[model samples]
Target: MNDPKLTPQALWHCALGLLSRRDHSRLELSQKLRQRQFDVELIEQALDKLEQQQWLSDHRFAVVQVRQHIFKKHGPLRIRMELKRKGVNEAYIEQALAEEDPDWFELALVCYQSRFRNRDIPDIKEKAKRMRYLQSRGFNSDQIRYALEAEQD
Candidate 1:
């Protein structure tokens, strides 16, 4: 190899250092190792070892991500898209969502309220604009409807 950092020990050292900072998905670790010019085979071995040792888990990553998004009041739809982009498994995503989010309607209302606090429902144009904004935030039509209805109270 052109660089001593390309060695298997060096690769493991680098991977462990990355993991010590925080959890990462397999794909994320692979991408980071590739960026550092580590051998693909070595990267695979490192990932496999990490998984066997329970250091890297898509499940754990998905759970933390879901909790963070829920705390931020982001809708499930947006969270799903983001986790999918990170290559998380669909099953894990669903599991995480089920464990973390109890009601999308409540989350949608919080998100809407945070953005449009104390503002009346206004005219048709403003209502439509609000609808579109919630949609962009990953709320389904039903959740948006419930949120808007609750706001009218």
Candidate 2:
């Protein structure tokens, strides 16, 4: 599918078509164009125009990704890492998370309850396991502590 004759207009339309499906970080769009064997210079030119037109923004992408991850019950750490992997700016990621202002402890509790639903953690080993589970899901130690204690109380 490599077409050496592909032009800038063609690349622009292709990029826009991809974005119409969903928001994409600049890096993600670039990689997709690269996969299609589009000329790197043409891809960059299209991206610059899109960004200039405010049609492709890392900020918007970060916000959308954050909301989606939150809906899936993921914690901030995981979401942040994923956005960073997608090449979103750290400032934008932080801004998006701040704007959401989610209750991390509550989310952690919900996540834990979904898995263990009122089941008492009978021993240190089991409690540690639950804490570790929440941590793996991206909740911080503080939030995990609150979830464990809040449920047992």
- The runs of at least 3 residues in candidate 2 whose Cα sits more than 4 Å from the true structure, single-residue gaps closed, are 1-5
Candidate 2 C-alpha error for residue 75, in Å: 1.3
- Model 2 residue-pair collision total: 0
TM-scores vs. true structure, each candidate = 0.93, 0.92
Go through the candidates in order and give each one's C-alpha lDDT: 0.90, 0.91
The weakest ten consecutive residues by lDDT in model 2 span 1-10
Model 1 lDDT at residue 82: 92
> So what's the TM-score on candidate 1?
0.93
lDDT of 2 by residue, 1-153 (tens): 256457777788899999999999999999999887789988998999999999999999999999998888889999999999999999999999999989988998899889897568899999999988998888999999988888889
- Top-scoring candidate (lDDT): 2
Q: For candidate 2, what's the RMSD?
A: 1.8
| Residue 102 lDDT (model 1) | 64
Pairs with backbone N, CA or C atoms under 3 Å apart (clashes), candidate 2 = none
lDDT score, residue 100, model 2?
A: 91
Q: In the order shown, what is each candidate's alpha-carbon RMSD?
A: 1.3, 1.8
